[model samples]
Target: MMNESHAGTARAALPLSWAKRGLVSLFDSALVGGRPQQRYFAALGMAEDEIFTGYDAVDNGYFAQQAETVRVDAAACRRTHQLPPRYFLSLGRFVPKKNLPALIHAYRLFLNANPQSETHLVMVGAGPEDFQLRAQCVKLGLQVHEKSHIPERAPASGKWEQQRGSKPGVHFYGFRQIKENPLFYALAEAFILPSLYEEWGLVVNEAMASGLPVIVSERAGCAEDLLEKGFPENATFTSISVRRAGLRSKIRRNGFVFDPHSPEELSRVLGLLSSVAELRIAMGRASRVIVEKFSCENFGRNAWLAAQAAIEKQRSPAPAPARGELMIPPA
Candidate 1:
């Protein structure tokens, strides 16, 4: 049921057959991939009865651990340097689908609109698309800085500065360690994941737990459920409305939805966020409250329970071989 990245291609190719077989259930962690797979499975005669219930992974214990870490890191960051009141951070692959280009464009707009704002954008993660994304950001007038002596090379001081003659507000910290990532999140004012597609987007949950407001795409499955719970009021949208106008109108009031292709809209939202410090703080606090129900321990427990239920269902004996005349043939 877990549609891991490695198996996605094969599963995509046999959508119909997989649905008919009914053994496979697609659990989309990346929000972008889940919706399409759900539709495909439905088309192949797999009813809601055959699929798993609920989408968000709940884990209370992990949340507690993460919360403690976030508090410590946030305090340490405040003591070390005078950090901005608010900033944006993202953690994902530097790929096209992750939508770095649009993010860069939107950030550029945000900076231009508020030249005096102290907001910063921090991006982490490496992929084949890193160079292209970096190049695009530079072209859009956002400054890029490579973190010299990465963990693979040597011990890093975790210190970074603005590049010379670059725009006043943009920064890029390339290839940071996983352990150091939480520190980045702790120092940020908000988390922005403007991905074109995602299956479940656990990073959003992590951001929420870190007490950071999240601005994610509607294409993410987590958004659908998270929005319902009313967490992270600042989680903006960047996708077309799949629902008709009626439903879209109802959801639009809950979050800011923009066309993923339009950097202007994205910039406008960021600019608005940057201008209002209280807004970010309120949204961040709200996000933390909303994600309390989605902890890692809860997720693990629920997954185990679901598996047990499925097993028990299978163990029950089938009804007597339906009026068959030759039930014991060749026995």
Candidate 2:
């Protein structure tokens, strides 16, 4: 049998306890989402070959194709959708665990520091936190526009100078279908997922496949495998590291990773990406390169390998009974 781990905190400990007692081998094989989970199982006594990585996946090719189609008429698509010309995208539920409030606060910080900047923060998805998140935007003096209310001729850049009683900073585009997501992914400068905790953010894969650089929170499960030059577990982005290397130097080759709890780090990262157009282009390309490895083909191949390995193990003869040990024959 091959099993995937998706248990929550309390339930997850049961397997660890079993593994500690040398019982984990009861399963023929196991698969994990990424290296982070792989390290966790390895630490719990799972063997290297018994564990497969990259089990969580999405149809990268589909999203890539959709994004390409949208790119052909990107300008018109933006107008039809009432989307800002250049903005960072956040696509996920508006739940507390997403830490959207922190993202909004960081965007505020970035705006305060870069007053002349015109890049908006476009949020797509609705959940319990919708009302609260919108309220937070209002409190921070950042205008919130629902998808329907956005002007047809939304400004290509800068504040909503043309639209009266409207500000252009944070947009709540509401929920989008899977097919419609590529439009936003295709047009955005970059994608961001600032979840406080996520088992595996498939949206990260979608964004990467759509050729958008990502700014993911370190706590996201995909952060380790999907982010280029995966964030160092021990690498602290404290004020000390920021000063020593400078902000530009800290930008990872693929994208940025920040502490979800630290709005300051997220703010600085936003500023860095916004100022470096060349870097964004390069990083977006890098995202495509990295995500290609997690394609549906690779996922199927890994599953086949696990099944083959498990079958071979099952066909092998059982270990001979030890001295003074009783063995029961198969019924």
Candidate 3:
């Protein structure tokens, strides 16, 4: 059994073709990460029974519980870290594939459209593109505040909110540990993952579990299964509801899905979420409900089922030799 997820426009060439051939010849079954990944496997002539989705997941319970704890003292955490009262959160490596430049440009457009909006863009991560991204922020005239290192398990300083100087700008909170992320998620109003090509964005899961509306790139592997939500809060969460919501997902989006290449589209989404508090709240609630179905336990169950299926297939006897065909005996 194989467990890999790489299905995006960027992977469209000789490499992917070779990968498909290898997969078909080498693996009897595969555990995929998302619905889009199933399509990739299906294209390789794999049967539905041979392809298992939902192989990627995070500790939703841990993120949720830690976020709840942060919420209990959100004001203090925000002040100590000097985070904006309301902001858009983006958690990922600052790489070209992650499309950090496009996000920053869209954020500029969003700020231009709503000059009075208080929402800021907070990016958390470090990579080779770190300096380039910071330069872009500076060229755009966006105040770039850098919080390079966060002490692990350090007590929060009792700082006053007014003294922290919260403002609407781009904040770069450098690489954070798993335990330190919930505070950033808890204080955020929404999450954005604008990757040019993502195999499976697990940060989307973390954000959803933390109860924030998400804006995901259409190219992300998880978008097909985790991005769309259009039904009202009162609607039941079922496959039937999903089908019904699919009809209105384009017009009545809760969790937004946008083309990563189009900064205008992402800008518009940012503006909408910033202006409408009610819409943000509704979408955040829906995100939590949707992400609950894709828990770590669900991933474990699917993996076990796939392994069992592979074992069963192996245990089945080989077909009888054709008539007059001689079988060679090995010494």
Candidate that would win on TM-score = 3
Q: How many Å off is the CA of 314 in candidate 1?
A: 2.1
lDDT of 3 by residue, 235-287 (tens): 34443433343423432335788889989888877876676677677778887
Candidate 2 Cα outliers beyond 4 Å, as residue runs: 1-25, 148-167, 230-250, 317-331
The true-versus-predicted C-alpha distance at residue 181 of model 2, in Å, is: 0.4
Each candidate: RMSD to true structure? 7.9, 6.7, 7.0
In angstroms, how far off is 187's CA in candidate 1?
1.3
TM-score of candidate 3 on Cα atoms, chains taken together: 0.84
lDDT of residue 68 for candidate 3: 90
Ranking by TM-score: 3, 2, 1
Which parts of model 1 are misplaced by more than 4 Å? 3-50, 53-85, 148-162, 165-167, 229-258, 315-331
The window of 10 residues in a row where model 3 has the poorest summed lDDT is 155-164
Give the worst 10-residue stretch by lDDT in candidate 2: 1-10
lDDT of 2 by residue, 115-193 (tens): 8888999998989987788788778888766562343344344332223332448877777777778988999998999
Clashing pairs in 3: none
lDDT of 1 by residue, 1-331 (tens): 5431212223454444544344433321111123444454555444444344334554533544665676666655643433334568878887777888888878888788788876777777878876677677667766655543343454243333334443344455566665566666677776777777666678777777766667777666566545443323454532232132222322322234455677776676676656556656767677666676665555555456556656665677334334632232331
Better of 1 and 3 by lDDT: 3
